[model samples]
Target chain A: MHVSAILTVIGRDRPGLTQALADVVAETGGNWGDSQLARLGGHYVGSVLVELPAGGLPALEQALRCLPDDLTVTLVEVTPEPHPPEGSRFSVSLVGQDRQGILREVTSVLAEMGVNIESLETGLEHEAWTGQKLFRADVQIFVPASLPLEVVADALEHISGEIMVDINLSEALR
Target chain B: MHVSAILTVIGRDRPGLTQALADVVAETGGNWGDSQLARLGGHYVGSVLVELPAGGLPALEQALRCLPDDLTVTLVEVTPEPHPPEGSRFSVSLVGQDRQGILREVTSVLAEMGVNIESLETGLEHEAWTGQKLFRADVQIFVPASLPLEVVADALEHISGEIMVDINLSEALR
Candidate 1:
């Protein structure tokens, strides 16, 4: 039987890195699946899903370990869940001047409301004219049906005012 | 003394593609700035910002043309704008069963309202239990200060009903 696994790889960026990983997976009879790989700050970081015969995992792991250039690989077994839990998906965004604790404060409120963050992307950018630093975040969250959007909005609005930043919460498309 | 340029590259997925591009830029006296690069469907695609002395641009272009494999590179000149126009930034999102004309219809409304889409990301996913295809989009937009948020929200709400989708519009955090 085939089993699913999550493989995370990280190393200094270099040429032929992806090919090396693919070569190992192919040799081990692992079928590559969904992955998000990127070069950040001169480091290659990625998470990949793979399907392989249950018996071949150890060999795959061993082969992956043999990759050159100090690449670190971690493998974890995963079971596919066919159904997503019932919840309303929403998108939350925050943008303001650079400051510490923005994520902490916002996520704290989310945690209090029993919200789960599914995906989040954050970055720092400069304002077009002033060239002032700006912190921006986009997050996808799952809100339990028991909680109302207004409750979440009110709580966030309260924080937004204190932080002097803009906070937007809306139902996610999908 | 320096000019900014946007470079976009797309090619078959392989190792060392980023390194290759970086080498060319470095040799051309370009300082890499911000970049977003990703692998999608066996293809590598990326956009990068570079700052370089004006005279180095021609050499950079020449070096990029010599990259191994058929990677396509396009460079466009960008001037740093000091100030954003007088407008409010907003987030607009829509989610519903996969259907045709959703983008066309929604964008048409924005156009009529004199709204500009700054960035947009859209995707399709399957429903958890039913496996139905769902289409979703998240957009960051600029609405002239003269136009109120309620106006944009109302226009989208009207289309949401006709398309049987959920739509939300709110001032973006900024």
Candidate 2:
């Protein structure tokens, strides 16, 4: 039976970084799945999903350990993901002036509500007209079946007016 | 005055792909802005926004020309991106069974209505139960002020029920 594992790697954004990782996967008889790799802060950061025979797990790790210097790798075997309670998905957006603790404040709210974040992408840019730094994020989340959609909406409504940001919350389409 | 240009590159996913580009930018006195770099189909695909002194534009392009082969690059100067008509930003998602031309059909509607796509990310996965292929995408877009949000909604409404896909559209928070 094939097992899956999550592998994350960080290194200088140089040529052959991905290929070196891919080589490990290939040599281990692993199949690389969906991966999100990008350059952040001038370094290469990536997480890959790989499936392989159970025995290949240790070999993959051993090979990763021998990869040349200056690279960091983390591998977590998914002994089968802990399937969350059946829940609804949510798509939320937050945009506002750049300030400290915005992510902390917002994520705190979601955590308080027992929501799980699935994916989040954020960016900071200068507003064209005023040159004010703008912070924006798009997040996809999962709300456990116990939470009501209206409850989430109420929570957002309560916080949106108090913050310096505009928040959009919706039951993301399935 | 500093001007901005968009640089896109595609090449084998190896070490130094991004650094090579950064080298050119640095050699020409260009400041790299935001860039999205990812691996797709076993190759590196990326687009970068860069700001550089007006004089550095030609030199930047010239240095790019001297780069080794196997890398394809496209540079476009944004004489200030044609300010789109006053409009709103939209976050749209389409998810359903994997099928050919799903992007074509959905993008056709947006294009026909003159909506400009800002960024799009998509993925395909296999359903755990039925082994069916699931396709999903998230798109960020700009709609000209001329188009009403409802018009876009209506267009989506018209298509959602006809296809095997479920779509979610919201005026992205800004």
Candidate 3:
């Protein structure tokens, strides 16, 4: 039986990092499925999905832990879940002057509203004219079918003004 | 001498599409540099950077144009620009009910303030409880050294109410 797993890795950026990881996966009879890898702040970070024979996971984990260059690897066995039924998917975006607790507050609201973040990317950019740093985030979230859009929007709207940030929520385009 | 070029391709999603493009690039002696490729809304779209011997651009373009599978290709020569000097980077995020002109209005403000957008991603999502469609956007912008943070933040803050969307701007984490 085939089993799926997620491998997360982080280390100082270097050449051949991907190849090194791939070599281990291959040796363990694992097939690379999908990955998101990037270098940020001189560090290489990535998460990859791998499929392998059910019995090979332990060996795969051991091999991954032994990779060179001080790379750290974490493995999680994943049971593929059934495809989710059709439901509402929304995109949430926020930007504000860099401050502490923005994510905490925003996520708290999401949690209270029962929104599940599917994917989120956050980064900072400078204002062209002012040179002021700004925090920005793009998020894809799944909303349950039972909630009212107004409630979620209203909840975010209520806090946005107080936080001095702009918030926009919309249905994800198909 | 080496020249850099960008290839933007779009076609119906299918296997072997990347291989076909790689084959053409290889035949033209182009070296793949980097790419962002994804399947979205049943279409395969990708932008790739390639390095080639200075004289091979025309042949590369010609070969790409003739690719099968109804693929569309556009090629542009890219002159690498020097990295911008260290300046503040900011993140901008926005969300509102899906509507026309949100981008136009928001971007207009940025342009008027002389902010430069480094990256922008936009999408729609449905509210989980309400099923209301929301429009969302995330943007990375470069702030010039001369502008004050308040000027940009205040500008967006002024419009958030009128636009019925939330907008936040913050300094990006280094």
- Among these predicted structures, which one has the highest DockQ? 2
Off by over 4 Å in 3: A82-86, B1-174
- The sequence of per-residue lDDT tens digits that candidate 1 reaches over residues A75-168 is 6666444355567888888898865456556767776777766555566789999999887777667787888888988999999998899999
Model 1 Cα shift for residue B110 (angstroms): 0.7
**Candidate 3 docking classification:** incorrect
Model 1 Cα shift for residue B158 (angstroms): 0.7
Assess every candidate by TM-score.
Answer: 0.52, 0.53, 0.51
TM-score of 3: 0.51
When sorted by DockQ, best at the front, the candidate numbers are 2, 1, 3
Instruction: Give the lDDT of residue A33 in candidate 2.
Output: 59
TM-score of 1: 0.52
Q: State the local distance difference test value for candidate 3.
A: 0.68
TM-score of chain A of each: 0.92, 0.93, 0.95
> Residue A17 error for model 1, in Å?
37
Give the Cα lDDT of each candidate: 0.68, 0.69, 0.68
TM-score, second chain, candidate 1? 0.93
List model 2 lDDT by residue over A1-174, tens digit each.
987776766564443555567667777877655555555444455556677886778999999999976676766665543333688888888888865446556766776777765555566789999999887867667787888988888887777777778999977765
